[model samples]
Target: MLPPGKIPPEKLREIVFNRLGAPGERVIIKSDLGVDATAIDFGSSVLVASTDPITGTEERIGFYAVHINANDVATFGAKPKWFLVSILLPENADEALLAKIMDELHESAKKLGVAIVGGHTEVTPGLHRPIVVGTMLGEVSEEKLVTSNGAKPGDAIILTKWAGLEGTSIIANEREEELVKVFGREFVERAKSFISMISVVEDALTANEAGVDAMHDPTEGGITNGLHEMADSAKLGLKVYAEKIPIREETLKICEFYGLNPLALISSGALIIAAPKENADDIISALEGKGINASVIGEFLEDKDSKVIVENGRERPLERPESDELWKIV
Candidate 1:
């Protein structure tokens, strides 16, 4: 049986990616391991589309569904303009539950200036909880289109925000009573507010404007998995400093309580950017100017098999996490 999180990359290549029937001629980007969104050639502009489902937490599922998919499109240097959702409820769900979800979806979409174009909603059988699947669409000019495969060997890798951001919020919300008993209501509430930082649309756009060869939002499997995906997609090796990667205090305490590796948790608010060494400083500066914390945590290397992380002056091979640390707790 497969793990509870995303399918392993090897299995994905064997069972899923290799099984896609006929390839579309207009598809500029096809299904791949690291690439989250697909681009279709449409004359002067390319249409970028991405889909993601929220099943980790019941709280703010609608908000998560919208921003998570939107983040994928924005990582390709596109502005998400239209959204579609499929809401599946459990058999015993009530109208109040659906109403709350719809309200969240509407507020989130409006905040992002995206239109809810169309979708389907139904009560699914045998489901224990509600699941919201969202698809986001955006357009970008051919010249401005950026893909995850564009990172070069010498480019500097930049990381925005802190690691394990989404997982921290999910844990705080899902385990509120337990956490509050140990850490008090103030700390738990602060951790829960991490949900507000779940979107990386601004981070991607600012970095793209400052000049980035590649950009990716760290979703499931946190920043470590995200860095691995970036290197794999670019066909390059990377050396990142463990000390340079930021982790908030709330996340640290919460992870310690659960014996989880923050770097291996789900991270949505953070972004991974690869840019030429010469432009890295400017990119960081632009992101910081917009009040988004960013740092050059590493650099891609010419050796494709040299992925490593430097900590305390020692180098260790960076292992790809089998599953997100969030699953162990929530």
Candidate 2:
């Protein structure tokens, strides 16, 4: 067998889908393009459930766990109502650290109006610092469910926030000592605030209100990966201008220091909204009115291959979430 990191993308796809199985009875696989979350249909309402572990990074794992799953559910235009969290602290972890994590988790969840329900936890020798996993439960009306596959040929794609926000943040926080010595202390300090912008709760709600056809948060992969997945899910193409892509100052610094493509990293808080051309302005207005920075990145096209138009009038196929550069830095 191949090493864990060297596993083929297709094989990993099989592992995930095989575990997902086929949708039956009360569960509907509903747009399983390795999108953020899964939904279960019960009666007239659809309940979205998504869980993710936060063992891989050090900075604000508790905060990330709360927003990440809720972002998944909110992508469907659903309001997050409940969250179940599991925090497994290492035996030797300090009580202050544990308290800080729990406090951050509760504060964020409460702000989002998501009640902490039920989960399990234990201290074990196998653990390192602490692992926090959260599952968010949200429900949407039957008529308004927007799948990642809902983007149409003529839909305009609007990207919110900067690209590679999460990946850059992780690298900055985790490699602070090295980055400070190499790239100066000011540059290193600037890279860490990317976490403050780590929630799509506003983006999702505003987009839905402004008549967005479909919405997705750019998480595991960056903006390009998200657009590719959306286009493929809808069996369409994306015509985007890479020059217009938003990149944060901190993100640019991190990408430059790490020799990475800013567009191919992780961005948990960014949202991509696909809407009709007429409602594009409305959506942008709604987003900007709420003080959320967004831009008209591109539009969906009829062409089969998803492409991003770049510098000097060149174009290339968009990046999908095959092997993210996030792993390289994080």
Candidate 3:
């Protein structure tokens, strides 16, 4: 069943069309709507817009809110330029909490040289908790516009960073009290630090610089889902090596405890880019130079049928993710 506050990505998309009429002239949706960001054609520059709202884990909400939208724009091969935020707080919300969130947003934006041009805030009964919605604007040259659909046959699949980083971080933060009581404080503390691993600005830029054809950030649906979308959008097939994907010691420990697959969990800070086989080495090295984890997990095949090769040598067809159990565990 769908959660009370959450909507399926498709249903949410239908609502968008229902309001805006047919997306034409003004909109150029290269990939499926509701995936990361939307790329709008603007002649010389492609305008990419992404709006993400922060909910659930409220402690580091502001920090994640900015990066989440920024990452979406980055995946489109754009430099995040502007932000428009919408902040809603409960009437009884503490002033200190609001101040802290604003401060965090400002600092993060400044680091990327992004300006918060305008936004609105309100304290009302309609909101029981704090919610921050960040809408980002970025520009990508038409020549360099990256799409999830840009994957090509024989392109090497490169995944950077540890798996399940975002999911593990959310779980630890949202359930810190219980986690500490059950999983030990050290583990919880380590997991919370995953917050710093939440930037895609470098990952996408470096991959594009290395002449990558496609870029996708694993979010909401995890790496497995991310790979499927990339292949599906490109009308291509992918071969994945389960053993080659990176999984952090902490992320794996928590996944094993919860009986979850790390690769299928949401990982925002990490990005998957399909680079020409010749550029794979330079791409990985560039990302690593910035102290980021990067790896070649597999490659695209001319065969339209996609499959993931397990560590045991078994093969399984890639499936469109029906649901993300990420929220359940975290």
Candidate 4:
């Protein structure tokens, strides 16, 4: 059986990355494990594109499809402009369901000022639920483009929002009955509302404005894994302070109830921004000015092979996250 969540990077390198046809000269950022989007050089500007499939969430799948894919491009300091989506419905799908998805897509695209240029829809032979895969394209001035590989040693590692934001919302919405019994209806409802926080476009844009060396959104494997990806791309080591990482009360209760590691859960809303030590505070202030909470969690190291997570007075090596903690309960 295929593994749940993301395919391991090692396997992806051996089977996918290593086999890709040589890229053209216009290709600025090619396929890489940590790099979020591909960049193509276009004279005065660079076109960035990112694609992701929304199969993990049942509620608001279309909305998630647009925002999630657009987020990748925004992390590169690009303003999303166009979207292409492939909506695949199960054999049992109906007209009403299709309309619902389309409405969501339209609403989300409008909110983000993105145009839905083209897409394909089909009722496939799949025996289960619906899926939406979206491709987001955006442009950025050549001088303003940023990549995950730009993180430098001694740069402060900044993180925005709390851990498990998307996962918490998904669990609350999809598994309301189980959660309500333990956390009560009010708390569960509050957690479910976190779905609206799943987009990191604002955080990314603000960090870009404030000047950042690198930016990465924590998604599948949450912040810890996101940090590892940043290090891998930058060819540097990292030391993350566990205590500095924020976790909401609702996330704590839910993760504890499900026996999941909050840090290892899917966290779409959170962004990991690497900036010079002097600029880190300004970046944090800029994000908070826009109503986003952020903090400096750690700094990059000169040793490219080392990665550590420190808590209290003890420190330990940071292991690569294998799977998202959300899969356990979902």
Best by lDDT: 1
**CA deviation > 4 Å runs, candidate 3:** 1-23, 26-34, 124-126, 181-183, 303-305
Global lDDT scores for all candidate models: 0.94, 0.79, 0.82, 0.92
Tell me the tens digit of each residue's lDDT in model 2 across 51-105: 7777558568888989888898899888899999888888888878878888888
| All candidates in order of lDDT, best leading | 1, 4, 3, 2
| Ordered list by TM-score, greatest first | 1, 4, 2, 3
TM-score of each: 0.99, 0.90, 0.89, 0.98
Runs off by more than 4 Å, candidate 1: none
Tens-digit lDDT track for model 3 on 141-224? 887878777889999999988778888898777778977887799989999899888898989987887799889888866888
Clashes of 4: 0
lDDT (0-100) at residue 162 of candidate 3?
A: 75
- What is the TM-score (0 to 1) of candidate 2? 0.90
Q: For residues 1-330, what per-residue lDDT tens digits would candidate 1 score against the true structure?
A: 999889999999889998898989999988888999999999989999999999899999999999999999999999999999999999999999999999999999999999999999999999999999999999999888999778999999999999999999999999999999999999999999999999999999889998899999988899999998989988899999999999999999999999999999999999999999999999999999999999999999989899999999999999989999999987
Candidate 2, which segments miss by more than 4 Å at Cα?
1-9, 19-23, 28-31, 182-186, 306-308
Model 4 lDDT per residue over 58-115, tens place: 6899989999998999999999999999999999999999999999999999999999
Residue-pair clash count for candidate 3: 0
